[model samples]
Target: MSQKSLEEQIQQLDEQLSSSVEHQEREAKFAVEANERFARNIACFEKYYPQIATAISEYKVREDFCIHVTTTGVGNFVPKNHHAPIYGDDPISQVSAQVEYGIQHPTFSATDYTASPILEDDKRIHIRYMGALTKAFQEIQAEQKERLTVLPEHFPSAMIFGIGLGYHIDLLLEKTSFDYCFLIEPDFEVFFASLFCTDWFSIIEKVDERGGSLFFQLGADEQTFIQDLETLADDIGAFSVVRSFCYQHTPLPEIIELIQQWSSQYFRFQYGHGFFNDAITGLAHTVHLVEKNTPVLTLPKQKRVDLSTPIFIVGNGPSLDEAEEFIRENADKAIIFAAGTAIASLSKKGIDCDFHILVERPYYNYKVFGDFLPPEEYKKTNLIGLNTLYPDTTDRYKWSGVAGKGNEAGTFLLEVVSQTLNNKGIPLMPYCNPVVANTALSFAMFSGFKNIYLFGIDNGNLPTGEHHSKDSIYRNNLDDENEEGLVCMGMNGKYLPANFGGQVESNDLFMGAHFQLEKLIAHYPNRTVYNIGNGAKLKGAHPVRAEELLPLPEANRDINEQVEFLKSDFFEQFNLEEFDDTLLGVKAFNEICDHVLGLAKEPVSSVKEASDNLLRQARYVYAIRNTALHHLHHMIKGALLYYHCPMLSLLYTYTDEQFTLESYAKVNTLWQGYIIEMKEYYQHNYRTKCDHGKD
Candidate 1:
């Protein structure tokens, strides 16, 4: 062999060895950096969100999921069982360009305001004026739509749909600051791969420093994603999500489903915005009832009742006519509950219920008993209702008991007062809202009835548009010219999945009640719930045909004795004099009013400033969440959103600096006036009424 050829061959071998060493060094450095990143992220999650921390700590890496480092030194995620990288050769530049494009064209731009003005003929000062103000601002927003070309530098809230390698999250955060950030990653493996590449610790620290929130919905699929979001919105102020800018990092099918679900049900946040009148009236009624020594429903502390007797929860739906025979035959064999206007239907059928439930707080509810049914019909039946129920309505019954309603200022105040006096507060009835059947179901559940059957509680109208029983007041109102027509504007164009395998027309109120019932049923997993008629298919309830009802053994126990036992088991009377000061909640109420008033009057220089001021108010309200006046947040949140959201839309849509400033000032002024009016009205009317009751 020639000496020159041998030397060349030797040189090539040495170069190969050097290249291998370089590759090993790079791999080692990458491993170290990944370990450091994982540790930091886990630590941050543990501090801020222990649930996420535990999930991440326990999650095992999928066999196919891995981090692929490109030649450009950027990490890309190779999703489950996929060989190809999620990002291209130059992932940094790819994600950078994508985020920049997303910034320019947000997937879900925050322009539309969800809160509709309450059109109820409420004569309260705030309700009357705020409704008019909201309508005016809504008009302004409609006019300024074309000008909403760019998002403000400081966005109020954001929803990041996916986190692939988390590059876009870093880029998005660097470009924009959000008060509330909801990061959702449907794939756990993808998120786990991201922990090695993304500096989540830094991101969390940055958000924390800004006094912002970061909600991580890890491993959430399309099925439960919106419900998760709803739970978060309930925990935080729902108003924060009113106009959130949504960014979809990875266009997955599940993410698309989530987006659609969110769009369809976003209006739910706008519902149940207890205005000042309702809040004050609820408080007054609650206070008056407690003072009258009305029996309150306490949570059951004993084991679940294993009675053979079934609970028949009756409602005035269209199916009532079909279930009449079933209810009549079973009435004597079960403890029957007549929900709301169902008493009229039951009276017509000559089937007396063991208990009659009422939920409405207004005088209209009190008039229902006097106007529709005579004293002989419901006088023998026991009354179970929310604390917000009209006091006079309970007077018609032989016996009555009230349970605390969730998400009401009156309930919160009563709870605090109860806690102050007895060291234990009242138990809030779960999902008792939007309808009377919900209250009846809640009562049945709390009473520990194992076998609860729903009759005529159809949460949707039939295909023929028959909503109520023939004997119901709803049908009676159609004939009586003096009775007002049904004001169901909210339910006019809605539909729901029917129990018997078809879609049925439903309203917002019924839909809400249906969902609430599902949630309540879920809380009692051991209990058996049967929906014995065609209705909106509830998630946790078993649908049964009226004719195919479960045949139970004849009830051996005396029905009257069982009814009295239930009353004694769940009901107690509170001494109002013991906690009169706490019951008023004047201090906390005034504090919240002061904070909101200041926020409304705060000066605004830019759209960002105006938005931030509104968010600041939300933070203030939510920060006092552990206090007795927390429900005040619920009371005012909807009304405040109705006022602020339209104003925000106008500000975001219109680029004219002077015009935006002027518009914000005008709206803010009107909002401030409303808050002031609310404070004064509550003090003069509700507070005075409570004080008088004490005297």
Candidate 2:
């Protein structure tokens, strides 16, 4: 019972395990008996499980492989129907028809034989069992425990790579509080066999009825799985929700390895996309904050048509060349919404869009409008511009309607300034990226366009040295230099053509923007997004040729009349108030700064709690303004809450406590300074507005 004696006994037992000759002989006899039992068990299974046996016999079984009994009484589909030197050059003629038929270029290590066999109808049905049924159960339990250690900190959700016989999946569901499980098995026969071999249908239905769901993805390749997984992630709300993954080893271990790799890359891609989008929103807010004096125009929130109406969103991809004539001929049939530089490209083709969307704040946007046409001439076409856009472009035409990002800063700033001016952030669309194409799509979807068509919205770029259409502003910079590791899912779901110096490469930004669009559209089940871009297919968006759609009759009114209608609508309910209440505005700003700054200074014990409080405060601030900064406020609060889930580091290794301790220090400091600066900005602006009103 002494500690030292127990340690010595354990060491002695360990040595005895390696040194006992009688034990070795007994194990040798056990192996011989197990193998014999395995051979008999195969015959027994063929007799008892006649359905499976008959199915297997029906196939033209390859000559190289046949059933072989292992030391643990398990039958293996051997490469040569017997033991063969694994390192030898002899070809493996075939593998298990049921399990290995769909597996391409399968790779597995040589089998290791060790433990005794327990007979259950001679003990051959469980081919992976290495010992007695009880011993195998213990080993599986231990392995499951080890694997479960990797589960995220909360209720688990699982994705099992191979649902072998449904045993592991059933056990996993029973053990974990997983609300959903995705079963991905490429071999249809194995899945089908399991249906008959086990009570899989009942178990799946039971889980479904219990408020947990089991998604069966049978006969899917790695590519299809990736696409489906992203769609599922979006359906479930977030990529981070699926915390546990089970990979059952088979003859095709490499495929499982690739699945693991792709899953990791997919998560990283989501994180990067989210981070980049936040940065852009932050940049836009900073610009809005800096240029408070810029003329802000209110956009009209008119419901021109019902959700059943079709809206064609045009972009500046090279594919526009193919759809140009079709769009021009049928421009009046559907409301044409042109994206950023697409306006120029469409205009050059003699196609006029009903509403042109512009979101980027860069000077490059100005180049989209040809120098030949002055601001007055360009006013013939109605425009929708985000307030963050370059001043020259947003202020260019009288027909253009300027809208602010529905964000906290935009709404707050607008509220303080809009008390005197006819300015308020209008909800453009629910979108992650502020890209023109995404914005335009959001506009259509928000306006209840049930049928949406995308033209030249190439998620993938053209061949190298050819990115945009000839008339687009981006065409000038389409060189091979920017053709870095960009890739998108082509129409066939494989990677887009990557010909180095020959084909155009799509950067992650373009591909990520389109993916966000896919997620956005997934929520609206009744709405459909058809991609007419002859390049990469936008996932969730069906592809259709332009000729298949119906062309509309000529419009009763010309483009000028439409522009006039839009301009009139912009000022119909405009309420322009003079900046007369400067003191009142400053008092409200100071009160808000005090409320948030006080909370920010307090020590936070939990990152989640702190983020929740901050976000709540942000919402309260916006509500105090009593006007919407729809996109802007949401982004600001999201960024505030997302501090713990840093875009640069998404490993989830750091706990809330660790994150909060580290972040609360620097972030709170920045938050304090930012609040003070914003307060000062409001005071200065209020005084300026009051002085202007007096003048």
Compare the candidates by TM-score and give the number of the best one. 1
TM-score for candidate 1: 0.90
lDDT of 2 by residue, 1-695 (tens): 89999999999998887667555665566457545544443454364455544544454534453333333322233232325421122112221322232222222111111233454443211211222323423343343221112333223245566654444454444444345567777765555434322345446556756555556666667546666665565434232233344444343554476467555445332333222133233334334433534434445556333345567789887777767777877776667888876776777777777777877643433553545345654675666766555445544554555554554343344445554344443343466354788878876675556788888887666554345676664524433456432232233222443312233355556656765676668756678888774555555778676666567545545544444544454423233333234323446556766777777677666544454444445446445433333323332233233232221121222334454345345545545665565555545443221111111
User: Residue 619's C-alpha lDDT in candidate 2?
Assistant: 44
What's the TM-score of every candidate structure? 0.90, 0.47
- Against the hidden true structure, what lDDT does model 1 obtain? 0.75
Computed on alpha carbons, the lDDT of every model, listed in order, comes to 0.75, 0.50
Which ranges of candidate 2 are over 4 A from the true structure? Answer: 1-310, 332-334, 361-373, 387-395, 402-404, 412-428, 449-451, 462-466, 476-508, 519-528, 546-572, 579-682, 685-695
What residue runs in model 1 are displaced by over 4 Å at the alpha carbon?
Answer: 1-26, 63-65, 81-84, 109-121, 301-306, 476-490, 577-588, 628-638, 687-695
- Displacement of residue 675 (Cα, Å) in model 2 is 5.4
